[model samples]
Target: MSITRRGFLGASLAAAMDGWQPAAAAGARVTLDQLQPGVYVARAHNAEVARANAGEVVPTLVHVTGAGVLVVDPGPQAAWGGALLGAIRALTPQPVRWVVNTHAHPENVLANAALARLRPRPVFLASAATAALMRQRCADCLARLQAQLGRAAMRGTTIVLPEPALQAGGWLHTGATAWQVQVHDNAHSASDTVLYAPQLRLLCAGGLAYQERVPEMQEASLQGWRQALRQLAALPADTVVATAPGTPAQTLVPTLAYLDALASGIGAALAAGCDASHAIDAVAAAPFRRWRHFHARHPLNVQRAWRQLEDLWMQGEPLA
Candidate 1:
């Protein structure tokens, strides 16, 4: 029998309340590489989410603090989150005190289910907009991930909404470490939260920066994203963590180039009287065709950019 979305979510929540366990049979493992003395990152495979990768296509950031550990973007599934928690325990005995979801993407936030099992549960945090988006979309996202990766891989996963929304320009303190939160709306997703650790000169840029990966633009605003990137580029960060792998300074380069090309190509297409249907072909893809997921995601990016630019044009607003 087909289960309704509400029914599926309700069942998942019931399972979670009954002390769900990670699906160890799925063979998910987490490995960490030190970015600094106390900063580390688990780099996800730079590819689309699949059963083979277990939907683990987004990087997870870990900050070891004197008080406890702070985890950013836990992961895509409960099993992966359990593995990540184990990896952290191996490195430090301090409990995870804070869990930060940089955005509302499934791959970035669903892991909170496993992490929620902590004895002294970590304070889950995200922007107000992100929390709202999660409330609206996470159930469907969870169901989709399960369908894509199989129930075994996503077993025990459930949606866990973040609490105490983080405000832009506010400071998040844990132990001696402080992260300046930067919030952007209508950019990467409906809301994007960036964290900068001044002491470590490290920046967790969420989906605002992609490393050699073609960004998904389904919920993006081309102009807003570019503006947010510009603001991020001005920060004094020595290391940047994002969705894919890249060096500090070069982390944002490919994303910027892709967005710039997308905007200009779409604008020109609009000026030439191309509608959404033809705009995809009109936008040049040669420069970014080699990027990961280019073929799968770039065409959609072109369509989204065309629509946004066309809307602006209709209102007599410059499509810059």
Candidate 2:
């Protein structure tokens, strides 16, 4: 009951890996780094800067349990999932007992089937809100992933849901460890979930946060997301692990800064009577020009934030 996570995950590595055929086409390998004593993050390069590296690793967060592991955001595609499993095996012999999808993205949760096939089977966890988004967007999600990961790589990929899904701020206990789960709607995607281990001071902040990349808005609540970050910043936890495997939590400050800037820019543009397209274009300007996918992502963020601002303005919400 007093096992340190490093002891659990870094145990028995001499014979850790299962026999796995690495993806020759994807030409990528999932490598594990012990960020903390028991916490391992599987990451390749900055997929934000290089999407070709996106297939390299879907970037997952692993929590070491006594005889098992808890994974956050198991990557995209069956092949990537297989690679992720092998990476974990290299760290410990503990079976993956639970997987939490931060949101309804294929890159995060499509590997559920592969993990579900373990001997005792793993419990899949997600918010009911995220599950509903999966149901509504599964087909479209598959289509987009297939186009990105290629049809062959995605073979056997399916939508897997958490049974008895949590609503918000639910408790998940694994052996001697427990995680407080929080779910969000209109923050990142239609929904997002973050898991916090208070004892360990670690937070697996699903899609709610990003690093070294521009955050996208797929039915996002721009202002709501800002509020969510404010809440996360208030947490006593010092270390936060988001979907991006190797990035530091301190970078979250700039990411939050970017979102706030987008919101303020949209509000100012609207107040100045700039049209939606013009506002989006105007916001596509400076400071964020250096971010990955700035041109591609800025317009969408502006468009979404613009609408939310319009409604708030109509409701007499004060603008700064």
Candidate 3:
């Protein structure tokens, strides 16, 4: 058969699309930055989540000690979990003894099975509220994640429950390493928790801190979130781990400041009677030009924050 120039090019383009691959996400390469002697944080990408690799946008924290290793928020799939395990192996031969799921969001807690079924299963932990929330939502979450990231990207993934879910301030000891569990409500998520290593003065704020990008408030409470930020600031930990770029402390202030600004900005917009749908243009205006994902995330943040703030205003409750 004879083919025209356009036909040949179209055929080749179709084949390329059929066999498409994301070069940037070829493998899960989370950089391990050593915070102190034995503490490391595999920082995730601060930009938007993509079909390329959903888990690459989430960070994981690794703590090593004589007993074993402990990991925090191990990404969103079996693949990410395997990458985390390999990262752990490169650091130490010790098995992963514990995993702390800081929240129920898939970005933070979906890689349980990757390391749970090792020589000795790793004990996954979270706040009791989070465990209950995960048990209720994880099956749906897995299906949704598979749909969003594709079955191939989510292959071998399973929802592993965080066992022995402890209350707030519970002490979880893994060998010589001890993590003080600090859980807060309605902050970053319905159940938000931070792990504090008192000795190392390291705090893993999980979703509460966004060092680079504008904060996403889909499941957040502005008032409660601000209170939680204050609590996090008061903690003595010098080392902070957030999901975004920049150092922990540098990220900390801006994250809080952005949230405060977001709340007030939205509040003013609401008071001025801007429609919820159109408030994004007003609230997320020029001043936030410096933050990343302003256009991508600001509209959603404005919409969600407006509803909550409106509810509070109508009920005669202060927009805490």
How much lDDT does each candidate structure score?
0.82, 0.70, 0.73
**Which tens-of-lDDT digit does each residue in 1-320 have in candidate 2?**
12222112222332232332434455335667777877877764545423465454345888788868988888776556666776677666788888887788777777775676565678888888887777778779877877875777676677776664765877888767778988767787778788888887777887666666778776788877887887887777767777464333554576788888877777888788787777666563576777777778877777777888888987989644
The number of the candidate with the highest lDDT is: 1
- The residue pairs found clashing in candidate 2 are 5-38, 6-37, 6-38, 186-221
Task: Give the range of the ten consecutive residues with the poorest summed lDDT in model 1.
Answer: 1-10
Which residue ranges in model 2 land beyond 4 Å of their true spot? 1-28, 48-51, 54-57, 245-249, 277-285
- Please report how far candidate 2 places residue 124 from its true position, in Å: 0.5
Model 1 C-alpha RMSD vs. true structure (Å) is 7.0
Q: Which candidate should be chosen as best, given TM-score against the real structure?
A: 1
Tens-digit lDDT string for candidate 3 (214-317) = 88888899888888888888878787887853455677777888777777877777677777765666564565667898877877887787788888877877
Please give the ranking of all candidate structures by lDDT, highest first, separated by commas.
Answer: 1, 3, 2
Q: How would the candidate models be sorted by TM-score, starting from the highest?
A: 1, 2, 3
**Which segments of model 1 are wrong by more than 4 Å?**
1-21, 274-278
Q: Decide which is better by lDDT, 2 or 3.
A: 3
